[model samples]
Target chain A: MNSTIALFLLQDGVINGAIYALLGVTLVLIFAVTRVIFVPQGEFAAWGALTLASLESGATPGTALLLVVLGVSAAVVETIRERASMRPARLGVMAVRDVAMPIALLLIVSTIAPTKPALWLSVLLTLALVVPLGPLVYRLAFQPIADATVLTLFIAAIGVHFAMIGLGLIFFGAEGFRNEPFIAGVFPLGPLMFKGQSLVILAATAALLAALWFFFEHSMLGKALRATAINRLGARLVGIPTRATGRIAFALAAAIGALSGTLIGSLTTISYDSGFIISLKGFVAAIAAGLASYPVTVVAAIGVGVLESFAAFFASAYKEVIVFSLIIPLLIWRSLVTAHHDEEEE
Target chain B: MRQSIRIALLSGGVCLVGTTTLAQVNVGITVSQTGPAAALGIPQKNSVAQLPKEIAGQKVDYVVLDDATDPTKAVANARKMIAENKIDYLIGSSATPATMALVDVAAETKTPYCAMVPSKAVVDPVDEKRKWTFKAPQNDAIMAESLAEHMAANGVKSVAFLGFTDGYGQGWLEEVEKAMPAKGIKITAVERFQRTDTSVTGQVLKILASSPDAVLIAASGTVAVMPQKTIKEQGYNKPIYQTHGVGTMDFVRVGGKDVDGTVFPAGPVVVADLLPDSHPSKKVGLEYIKAYEANNKTPFAVFGAHLADCMSIAANSVKPALEKGKPGTAEFRSGLRDAIETTKELPATHGVYNYSPTDHAGLDNRSRVLIKIVNGKWTLLP
Candidate 1:
C-alpha cells in the first residue's frame, strides 16, 4: 500500500485503539479488584451511546427507567442481605441514594429530553443514566457473591451480559443508532487528514489516562482500591471496606465504558448487541497484558488495533479471526513466561 | 321462562353442530424476533396482524413462534409446529440459514412452505425437498441484473464489492460476478465484513487503493451504512450501488446524509405511492402499506411487505385447494401446493406472482424497480 493509505489506516487504527485502550484498562481494573471479567462492560457503553442518541432525538431514553428498576432491585437485595446489621440511618441512606436518586434523575431527564436539550446536557444526562448502572449491577448481581471463585464470578458476569443485552434490545429497539459527532471537521497532517472526532477520542483517552494515574498515585481511595486489588482479605482486615472498593472499581469501569461509547458511537453505528464485539476486542488487549499491567494493556490495545486494521486491509473476511487469534499466541507466551502459583494456597 | 330456556338450548345445540362442521386451516410462522435478524423479523411478525383471520370460508389459525435467528431452533420450531399444531402451511425464519433449516421439515411433512428470505437456494431446481417450498422476495440474481444494467448504462466499467460474510453476501457476490461480467464490467476489489463490524476503514482503504469506478455494497439492514459512510469519509465520491436488502427506512434513517445518493434495486412496493397507476402492484402495494402502517402504528418497512406477499399468495391458493379435501388432510396440502404452483397473474404488495412447477419464487423483472435515496426519501429512477 502507498504511504498515504497506510497513514490513513494508521489514523483509523489509533482512533479505534484509543477506545479499546479505555475498555482494556477498565477490564484490568475491574478484574483486579472484583475478580470479575466484566463481560457486560460494553453494554454500559452501548447504553450510554444509545441513550445520548435518544436524548438528541428528543425522546425519553429507556435507560432512565432501567436505572430506576435496577436501583429498586439493588436496594431490595442489599436490604434483605444486610438485614441483620442494618441500622435506621443506613436504611435512610439506602432509600435516598438507591431509590430516590434514580427516580429524581428520571424525572429531570423526562422533563428536558423532550425539549431536545443541548448536546452537552444530553451527554451529561447519558452519563448520569448509565454510570450508576455499573454499581447497581454490582450491588444486585455480584455483592452477595463477592468472595466466590473467579470462574463463578465470570459465569455471573456472562449472565449479567445476556440480561443487559436483552434489556438493551427492549430499550433501544432493534434499529442501530449513530450520534452526531461531539466535534466535527478534519485537520490535515502532512499526507493524512485526521477527523475531529478521532482527535477528540485521542485527547479524551490521554486525559483519562493521566487522570487515572493521578488518582492511583495520589488519592487515598485509589490506594485503598490498589490494596484491595493486591489482597482482598488483607484490605478488609485493615478496615478498607472491600465491598465499597468493588463498587468504586465498577463505577470507574462504567464511566470509562460510557465515555468510550460516546466517542465511538459517532464513528460507527451502535446497536443493542454491538457492545459484545467491541468489549471482546478490549478483552483481547487485557489478555495480551496477562490482565495485570495497565500500561501494557493500553500499549497492547493499540497494537491490536493496528494489527486488526492491516488484517482488514489484507483479508477483510478474516479480520475478526485474525484479531481474536492473536490472543492464542499471547496466551501461550504468557503461560511460558509467568511462574505458576496456586491461588488456594494464597 | 320455560319458552326462553328452550329457545337458548336450541341455539346452543345449533352452535355446537355448526362448530363441528366449520373448516379450520392452521398456518405456522417462525421468525427471528429477538436476535440479530430481529430488525427484519419483527416487521414480518407485525405483518402477521394484517393477515386474514379467515380465508376461503375456513377459519384460519396462525401459530407464530420466534426462532431467535438460530437455525437449530428453526428446525425444532418447524418440527413442533408440524407435529403439534398440524399446520398445513408454513412461513418463516426471516433469515436464509434459519429458513433453509425449515425446508427439510416442510418436505417431510408435505406442507406448503413460504420463505421470506431472498436466497434462491431456498427453492431452485425443483428438487424433491424444494417442491414444497416457495419464497416471497425477488431472487438475488434478478436484483443484481438490475443493478448491473444501471451501472453499465451509466458508463461504469469497474466496481468494488463489499458485503457481509454470511449467506446473503456470498449469494449476492455470486450473482454480481455473473451479472457484472455479462454487462462487461470488471470487479476491481472484493471485501467482506461482519454485520456487527464496528469499522470498515481498512476495507474502504483497500477499495480505494484499487480505485474502481463505482462501489457495490451487498449488505442489508442498518449495517449497510458503514461501508458507504467510510468510503465517503475517505473522500471517494464515485457512484455507490446497494442491494435490495437495504430497502428499509431504518437504513435511510441511520445513513442520513451519507446515503443521499445511494442507488439500489428494491421491490416496487417501497415506492408504491410513486409508482404509476399502470403498474401492476401499485394498488395492492399502497393498500398493504396503509394497512400495515395503521395496524403497527409505525411506518411500513419493506421487509414486512415480503410477509404480506406470502400471505397473499397463500390466501389465493387456499380458495382453490379447499375444493380438493378438508383443511387438515394430506389431500388438501398437496392440492394447496398445486394451487400455489398454478398461481397466475396474482398481484401482491411486492409484485405479481406467476408461480409454476419450475419457478416457486414467481417474481419477474416487474417486481424490481431502481430507487435512489434523495434527501432521505426513496425516489424512483427513470
Candidate 2:
C-alpha cells in the first residue's frame, strides 16, 4: 500500500502486460485474416522456450522434427491439390519453399545447436524452428476450408490447440524448464531495483510493436495484407491472393508468440501445460479490445496486467477469479455502447 | 520305458507348483508416475526397483501401477491391486489426495497400506478404519514443530506464511499456526498461490511490506521456486524457511542462486553424510542413498528414500507373515496387517518407526532434521 511497494507492483504488472500485449496483437491479427480465434498461440511460446532449453543442454530439440513433419505434410497436401493444373516451375518453387527450406533449416540447426551457440543465436534458431509451423498448421488445418463459417473455424482452432498441447508434452516431457536470462543483471532505479530481464522484456515488446507498425504502414506486401484483412473477397478481386495473406498473417503471429515465449520463459519456470492459462489471459485482453485496434489491445493488456497485480495483493487467493471476471463488464459495455453489425454481405 | 518317464514328469510339475505357491510374495504399488507429480512419483518407482528382491526367504514380486496423480485413478488402482492382484501388502501414491483416497481401499480390503506423502491426515487420530494404514514419511506436524523450534532458538519473534492454495498449503499453515503461537511467535501475514502460477510478484510485495522476521514458503516441488526467486529478486533479505516439500534437487536446481541461504526441514537422507556418526537414521539412510544413486540417473531424492522406507516397513511385516504361513493366502495377508501395526523401533532411512494399534504414522520428531542450503549444498544444522 505504500508508495515504494506500489511502485514495485506497478513495474511487475507492466512487464507482464507487455508480454500479454504481444499475444493480444497476435490473436487479433490471426482473427482478422482467417476468422479463426487462434487458440493455440500460446503453444508457439511453449515450443520456443523448451526448444531453447533443449538447445542449451546440447540435445536435439524435438521441435525440429515437428517443424519438418508439419512442413512436409502441408507441402504434400498442397501439391496433391494443385497437381493437375500447376506447371513444373511453379511446383518446383512450391516444393522449395514448403519442404526443402524446412529440411535445410533442420539440418543447419541440428549441426549448430549441439555446439551450444551464443544465447542470441540460440534464440534466433528457436524462433526459426517454431515460426514456420504457424503457416504449415494453417495450410494443413484451415486453408482447405477457408470459406467455412466462423464457428467451424473456431472449433478447428480448439482442436489444433489440443493437438499442439499433446505434441508439446511429447517434445518437452512433463518437466518444466527455466531458461537463463537473455540479459543478466539488476538495475537500480532510485528505490526500486529492476531485473535486467524485465527491462529486456519491455524494450523487446516496444521494438516489436514499432516493427509491426512499419511493416503494415510502408511495405506493399503490408498494404496487401491490410487490404485482405479489410475485405477478403474485394482484395481477391483486386488481384491480392487472400490465401497468401492468411499465411503471412499466421507466420507473423507465430514469430510474435515465439519472441514472447523466449522473454517470458526467462522470467518464470514454464511447463508444457503452462500455455493454456497464458493464452486465456491474452484472450481476455483481446476480448477487452473487441479483437480489433492494436493500440487499444496493448492498452487493455496493460490494464489487465495491472489489475491482476492489485487483485493478487488484495485477495491473493481469488486473484485469478478477479482478473477473469473483468471480461464480463467489458463485454457488456462494448455491446451497449458500440454499434453491432453482422459480417459484410457476401 | 515311455510310461515311466511320463509319470516322473507329472510328479516334477506338481512339486514345482507347490514350491511356487509357498515362496513368492506380491507387493503392489501405485504412484503418480505420469502427471504433474511425475517428477516425484517417478523417483518412488525407481526406489521400488531398488528394493531387496528377496526379503527374508520369500521372493518379492512388485506390481507397479500409475495413478497419474488423480484421486479417482488412485482409488481404482488400489482396488485392482487388492482384488485382481491379491497383493499381500500395498505402498503408494506420492501426493496427499491420492494417498488419502487409497486409504479407504486399504481399510475395506484389510490390506496393509504404506503412504508416502507427508500430510498427517494420512494417519493421525487413528481409529478402526485407519488400523490397516501406516505412513513412512515424517508428518507435517512433526516437521513444523522442528521448524518452529529452530525459529524460537534463533530469537525469531515473527514470521510470514506463504503456501500453495491446496491441501499441502493448508496443512502446513495449520501445523505452523499450532507450533508458532505456542512458542510465542506471532504470524504477521499469510499468502497463498497456485502450483501452476507463473508469478508471485504481488504476493511477494505484500510479504516484503509486512517485513516479518522470516518467511516460511509451504509449497512443494518445483512450484515453490517461483515465490523463492521472486522474494530474492525483490531484495527481501531475512531468514527464509521452506517445508520438506522443497527437499529435492529439482527444487534446488530451479531456484539456483536464490536458494543459497534458505533453511528448511528435510528427511535425514538429504543430509545423511553430514549428520553425526551416531545418528540413528544415518547408516540406513546412507545405504538407501547408495542404492538409489546407483540406479537413478538423477541425484538422490528424499521421495525415493521415503518410498524405500515404506517398502522396508512392508518387507519387515511380510517377513513375519512368511514365517508363520504360506504366501498369497488370506491368513498370511491378515497376519501381515497385524504385524505391521505392532512395529517397534524399526530403523529405516527416514526414521525409526514405532507403529501401534492407536497410532499408524509411526514417525516422530526424530524423523526430521534441520537442513540449510549452504553454498548450494545441504548442510546439517548443529
Candidate 3:
C-alpha cells in the first residue's frame, strides 16, 4: 500500500501486462480468423520453457541459417497441400499434407541443429500442430458450426481446452521441471533493485511491440492484413488474399506464443498443467477487453497479471482466493459497462 | 508340514486364549491423500498406513482414513474411525485443523493420541496437553527457532515475510518473528495471502520494493510456490526464506527454477546433501531411501520417510510388552514413549535420535539446517 510496495507492483504490472497483451493478441487473432480459439497456445509456451535450458547449452547457432532453407521446403509443402485440397476426390490427402508441414519443418530443422535436442524434440512434438492443423479444424469442426451462435464458438473453445490438456500430458508428460533464471546479474539503484531477467523481458517486449507497430504502419503485408481484419469481404473483393493474410497472422501469433512460452520456461519450472492456469488468465484478459479491441486486451492482461501476482503474494494460505476475487469483480464490472455501451449503441 | 503347523497354532492359541485374545489392539489414523494439500498429507497417510506392515510380528490392526485435504470431511472421517470403527488407539491427526477437531473427541473419549499436527497448540492443547498426548516431530517453536538460527548463520540481516493469514501460518510466523530480532534479523515488510491465492505479485513486489536482504514465506505446500515464481519473474534476486511448511517436496515441483537460491529451514534429512560421507545421518538417509523406494515403489519424501522411522520406534516400544504378555492401550502408549526415549542411538534413516520426556520429538537444536535450491537440485549451502 505504501510507495515502495506500489512502485514494484507497477513495475510487475507492466511486465505482466505486456506478457498478457502478447497472449491476448494471439487468442483474438485465431478466434477471428480461424473461428477456433487455439486453446493450446499456453501449452506451447510451457513446452518452449521446458526446452530453454537445453537450448542454452546445446542448440546449434546455425539454426537461423537452417530455418532459411527449411522455409523454402515448407513453402513447397504448402503448395502441394493446396493442390490436394482443390481435388474434391482426394480431400483426405490435403488434410494429411496440411497436418504434416509444421511437424515436418520442426523435425527436419531441429534434427540438423537442435541444441537441447531432447527438450526441443519433446516441445516440437507437443506444438507442431500450430500451423498444419488450423485448416483441418476449419474444414472438419468450424465449417459445420460457422453459421452457429457466438456461444457455439465459445463452446468449441472449451472443447479445445480439454483436447490441449490431453495433448500436453500425452506429449510433454505430467511432471514439472525447474526453469533456471535467464538473468544472472542484478544491480541496485538507491531504492530500486533490478534483475537482469526482468530487464531482458521488458526490453524484449518493447522491441517486439515497436517492430509490430512498424510492420503494421509501413509494410505492405501488414497493411493488407489490417485491411483484412477490418472487412473480410471488402478485402477479398479488392484482390487481397484475405485467407492468406489470416493464415500469416495466425502463424505469427503462434510463433509469438512460442517465444512467450520459451521465455516463461526459461524463467520458471513448468509441467503439463501450466496451460490450464494460462487459459484462465488469458480468457479473463480477453473478456475484460470485450474480446474485440486490441489495446484494451493488452492493458487488461498485464493489469490482471500484476493484480494476480499481488493476490498470490497476500493470502497464500488460499492463494487462489486472491485471483478469483480480483478477476470476478472486473468481469462483473465489465459486463455492466458493456451492457451500458450496447444500450447507447442501440 | 502346513497342516501340522495349523494344528500346533490352534493348540497354542487355545492355551493362550485367556491372554492373547484380549489384546490385538487397533490404532486409527486419518489424513488427506488426494486433495491440494495431499502433497503433504499423503506422505503422513502413507507413513501411517505402512506402520503395521513394518512391524509384522505385532498383532496390531491399523485403520487409515483419507480426508483428502478437507477439514470437515476429515473430522467426519475421524468420527467414523473412532465411533463406528471402534479403534482402540489413535495414532494420527495430521494437519492443525484436523488434529484440533480430533483433540475434542480424544479428550472426550480419553483416547491416547500420538499427535502429527505441526502447531504449538498441539503440544499445549486448548485444555492443556493431556498425559495421554505425545508428539513425534518438532513443533512450531522449534522450527521458528531453528529457522532464525539458520538465517543468522548465513549473515542474513533483514527479512520480508509473506505468510497466510490463518492458524498455521500465523502461529508459526509469530514464533519466528519473535525470535528474529534476537538473532539480529530485521523484518522490513509483512504481507498476508490466503493459502489458495494464485498470484502473490502485490505482496512480492512489496517485499521486492523493500529490497530486504532476504524473504521468508511461512505458508505450506503448493500455496507457497506461486509467489516464489512471480517474484523472480519480476526479477527480485534476493535470497527467499521459507520455514518448515514451505521447504518440502511439493513446493519444489511448483516453484521450479524460480526457487533456486531460495533457502528453507528444515530437519537434518532435508539438508542431507550437506552430510559428509562419514556422517552416520548420511548413512541412515541412504538406507532409508533405498528401503523405502523398494517397499513403496515410489520415491520417498523426506518427511514421509522420517514419519515411517518415527512409527518404527513407536511400535518397537511395545515389542517387549507384547512379548512378556499382551498389553492394553495405556500400557502400550507409555511403553512406546519410554521406548522412544531409551534409544541412545536410533540408527534411524535420518540420524541417531535422542529424546527425553521434556523433548517429545527426539530432535535437538542440531537437527535443523539450511538447504538451498541451486538450479533444479537441493543442496546445503553452509
User: For all the predictions, what are the DockQ values?
Assistant: 0.64, 0.44, 0.18
Q: Enumerate residue pairs that collide in model 2.
A: none
Candidate 2 iRMSD in angstroms: 1.6
Query: Per-residue alpha-carbon lDDT of model 3 for B75-103, expressed as tens digits?
Result: 67666655544454566555667766776
Give per-residue CA lDDT, model 1, range A1-346, as digits (tens): 8888788878888888888899999999999999999999999889989999999899999999999999998888888888999999998998999899999999999999989998888888899998898999998899899988888999999999989988998889999899889888888889888888888999999999999999988999999999999999999999999999999999999889988998888888899999998989999999999888999999999998888888889999999999998989999999999998766454
Q: Arrange candidates by TM-score, highest first: which order?
A: 1, 2, 3
- CAPRI-wise, candidate 2 is acceptable
- Give the C-alpha miss distance for residue B4 in model 3, angstroms: 39
lDDT by residue for model 3 (A232-267), tens = 668789999765665566566656665666555544
Candidate 2 on B1-382: residue-level lDDT in tens?
4996476446435434644566677788899877667767877888877887897777777778788789999998888766656677889898888998888888888887889887787887788777778888887888999989999999899999998888889989999999999989999989888776767888988887788999999988766777888888877888999999888777777778888888899888788888788888999999988888788766777888878888888788877776667777778878888888888998888988999887888987778898898877778886
Off by over 4 Å in 1: A82-85, A344-346, B1-22
Evaluate all candidate structures by whole-model CA lDDT and list the values in order: 0.90, 0.84, 0.60
lDDT of model 2, residue A113: 81
Locate the minimum summed-lDDT window of 10 residues in model 2 chain A.
A337-346
Tell me the lDDT of candidate 2.
0.84
TM-scores of the candidates are 0.96, 0.87, 0.62
TM-score of chain A of each: 0.98, 0.97, 0.72
Off by over 4 Å in 2: A56-62, A65-107, A136-163, A217-247, A334-346, B1-23, B323-330
Top candidate by TM-score: 1
Best DockQ goes to which candidate?
1
Ranking the candidates on DockQ from highest down gives 1, 2, 3
